[model samples]
Each structure stands twice: as structure tokens, then as C-alpha cells.
Target: MGIEYKRRYALLLAARDSEYVKKVYGGYFNVFVAAYGDEEEEERWDMYRVVDGEFPDMDDLQSYDGFIVSGSPYDAYGDDNWILELCFLLQALDSMQKKVLGICFGHQVLCRALGGKVGKSDSGWDIGPRKVNIVNSCSLFETLFETLPALTIIECHQDEVLELPIGAEVIGFSDKTGVEMFRIGNHILGVQGHPEYSKDILNNLIDRLLSQDSIEIDQANEARSKLEIQEPNSKCWQEICKAFLKGLWNEYPSIEQ
Candidate 1:
């Protein structure tokens, strides 16, 4: 008899869920599953709050087909112990040739882990629906994103990837940040914006940021106004992510040395 197997993925979350997410979305794990999982496919997703010291065991790395890192409030370049440990974990994933997708802080940390540079953005905060230009479209993602010249995604970050790892290629960028999306080899992809976020989620985030004084009231209002006027291309971003992780691209160049 043939055995049935299902694909599995991991979420290396770098932050704790906000009370709002927990209450409204049933936590960040569900939010990710909703964004990345195929409703028809019998795939499994596991969450590991790496910020809380939970990580997949070294022996179980092969059990997962891909890994996705979640955004965090913490700075990617911070010298915290957990951040360093996450870097080591990312390096191990790269060595194993496992697919890893990073978002927001995840994007910055992946670059740092792979010998790239990440630091505070000199242009200050980038909030709201930001248009990211598709500078290079390889065969893998061209048709998947419908060949759009630019895609807007929700952005809320103060740090940016200053340099890419040696073989990493910049596939997408924005007016505020140079490196919006980067791919390393066939296994690693990083996106600087939040594709999983809905307008409501971003609005909540803006409110929280304002309450904490991370952003001024004027900035928050402007971002909220933009959200009301134009929506981010969430469907396109989700498809790009799905294609990248599901190995839909037939002719992507290898970034490996």
C-alpha cells in the first residue's frame, strides 16, 4: 500500500502576538496559515516562538518542507541572545537547502545572518501601503504575480537591509527602501513588507505604534488616510510567497556559490 504524506512548514516567529491579534485573529499562527496555506492541500504548519526560546530541534529539520519567519518589534541588528541564536538557525536552514521565507524584521535578520548588513533606516519610518517595484522578474515569479510592474504591500519598519548576502539578488524594491525583496539561492527569500496583513491589522498596528509613541499622531493619520484611499495588492504578494515556497518556478537561477 502506498503511504500518504503531507507537506509541513514552520513559523519561526520573532515576536509575541499582540492582544489584538490574539483576540481578533486567534493569534499570529492562524494569521500566517490563512495567508500561506492552500485550503485544498493537506499541509501542516507548526509555530515556534523563537523569541520565547522555542525552536525546532536539529534532528527534526528535515520534517519541514519550508520555514517562514515572522516580523518582530525587536531590531534585527540587536545583539540579543535570541537574535543571535535565530541567525545560527537560519544559517543551518540555508546549509540544508530548505526553503525559508522572511518577512519584515525577518527579512532584515536573514540578511544579517547571511553576512549581509541591516540597520536603522535613514529615511525614518515607512508605514502604510508602499509600492514596491519589481526590478527583476525571473521565470519562477513572473507569471505568478501576473507580471505587475509594481505591487503595493503594507509596510511598517524602521530598519532596512543595507546589503544583500554575496549571492543574493534584489528582486523587488520601493521608493523608501532599496532592498524590498531578496532571494538567496533557491531556498531563501526575504520580503520587507507584511503580505499577511490586512488593512485592519495595519490600522491596529498604527494605533498601537501611536499609543507607544513609536510614530507621531500625524504620521499615523496620514498612513490611515492612505489605507482608506488605496489598498495593497495582498493577493499578488500572497501568490508570490506561495510560488516561492511551493517550488512553482521552473527556471530560477541558483544563487548558490
Candidate 2:
């Protein structure tokens, strides 16, 4: 073999490791690792609970090959100290041309950090499995476009990217959300859905949302019903995300390649 190399990735966890997540998925970190990590490879992911004010040091930023921002219960537009700090961190990552992937709250926050507008959706809350139509605008991901015309992903968010950042472009959309996915050149990408979520996790979350009065009984039931029949293309999404993070622009190439 010529050489052995491994790419390091960090998960900027924006939510607390909930009791439910821990009980069901062995913690939120496990959930993300299960979704995006190569289990056979021991040296891959790092976790930082940013919601708890934990973050990777600035000097160590160059060590990671890419970063992933997890969904949060908190508003991305809020002026909390940690949120501000995370925004500054994101700006620095962008400047360094380091790859960053944002999911849900991460998506909205990245937009906010990079000169975009985000707010509560005028169309209201979008919960459960949603089908996102990939747009053909971004030529940079032609292979991804060719592979997946549309993808169904687990969505649970009220905030959205209303106006894209200075150089961001919408690459995916859904009926409920205008900006389902966006890209900033090749280094940054944001997705408004939880490709990491499993049906059981979403079901548990639905129950919690119902108890908290965040979603109506009918809406929750409808979302569950759809999940009974439709499966989100988690595999395809994993490929796309891994490709972007690994700096593969060809055809959603595998990480090992």
C-alpha cells in the first residue's frame, strides 16, 4: 500500500444528549456516528456538545477534515452566547475553505453565520418524513443530482433559511419548506432534514412534540402513517454527505476511494 490515511470529522452537536436519545440510540453521538461513520474504522469522528458551550479549540480547527452541525432545539437566530460563538467559528471555517455540513438548526445557523436570513416558517411547522426535490441549479453536484432526483428525509423544524447567504444557492426544496438544501461553493452545505434520524427516533420525537403541544394530534398521526409506508432514502443521503465531507466532487464517491 502506498499509504494509509484517515479523514477526521467533528460533530458540533447543537442539542443535549437527551434521555430518549440515549436510551434508544445509546446517545445522540451514537446516532450521528451510526448514520455517517464507518463502524469498522475506529479513527473517524469527534463529538462536541456545542449546546453545552463545548467546542473544538480554534487552533485545532485545521486538524479536522470536515465538520457536521447537528439539529438543535434552540433557535438559530437567537443571540445566545454559545450561538454567537458557533457563528464566529463557522465564519472562520468558511474562510479556511474547510468542509462543513449543517443539518436542520445547523442549516439555519450556518445561513445566519454567513449573511443569510432565517426565521420561523410562515408556512408553519413541518414535521415527520418529507420528500425533498433536488434542484438542478448547482452544477457542482451533477452526480448527486443524477443519482437522486428526490429524497425523503425526516424533518422536524419550524425555522427556515428565508434568504440565502451572499454566495449560497438552493440545491434542494420541498413543498413545505422553500430551502430544504443549500450550498456555498464546495466547502459548505446545509440540509434542513435529519438524515440521521430513524423511524423509531422520529416516532419518539412525535410523541414528545404532541405532549409539548408543538404539533397537533392529527399532524402527528399523519406523519406516523406516512412513515408506515414510505422509507426515507437514508443510504443515498449518507453517500452524498460523505462525498461532500471527503472532498469528492465526481459521483458521490465512496469514502474509501
| Best model number under lDDT | 1
Q: Score every model by TM-score.
A: 0.93, 0.93
In the range 73-153, model 1's lDDT, one tens digit per residue, is: 999999899999999999999999999999999999999999999999999999999999886455445544444558889
Position 186, candidate 2: lDDT: 94
- Which sections of candidate 1 miss by over 4 Å? 1-4, 137-146, 251-257
State residue 179's C-alpha deviation in candidate 2, in Å: 0.7
Q: On residues 1-257, what C-alpha lDDT tens digit does candidate 2 reach at each position?
A: 64343778899999987679888778998988778777655446889989989999999999898999999989999999999999999999999999999999999999999999999999888887889998876788875575566788989898999999988899999988999999999999999999898898888889988999989999998889989998888777876787788777665543221
RMSD to true structure for each model, in Å: 4.2, 3.1
In model 1, where is the ten-residue run with the lowest total lDDT?
Answer: 248-257
C-alpha positional error of residue 1 in candidate 1 after TM-score superposition, expressed in Å: 14
lDDT of 2: 0.88
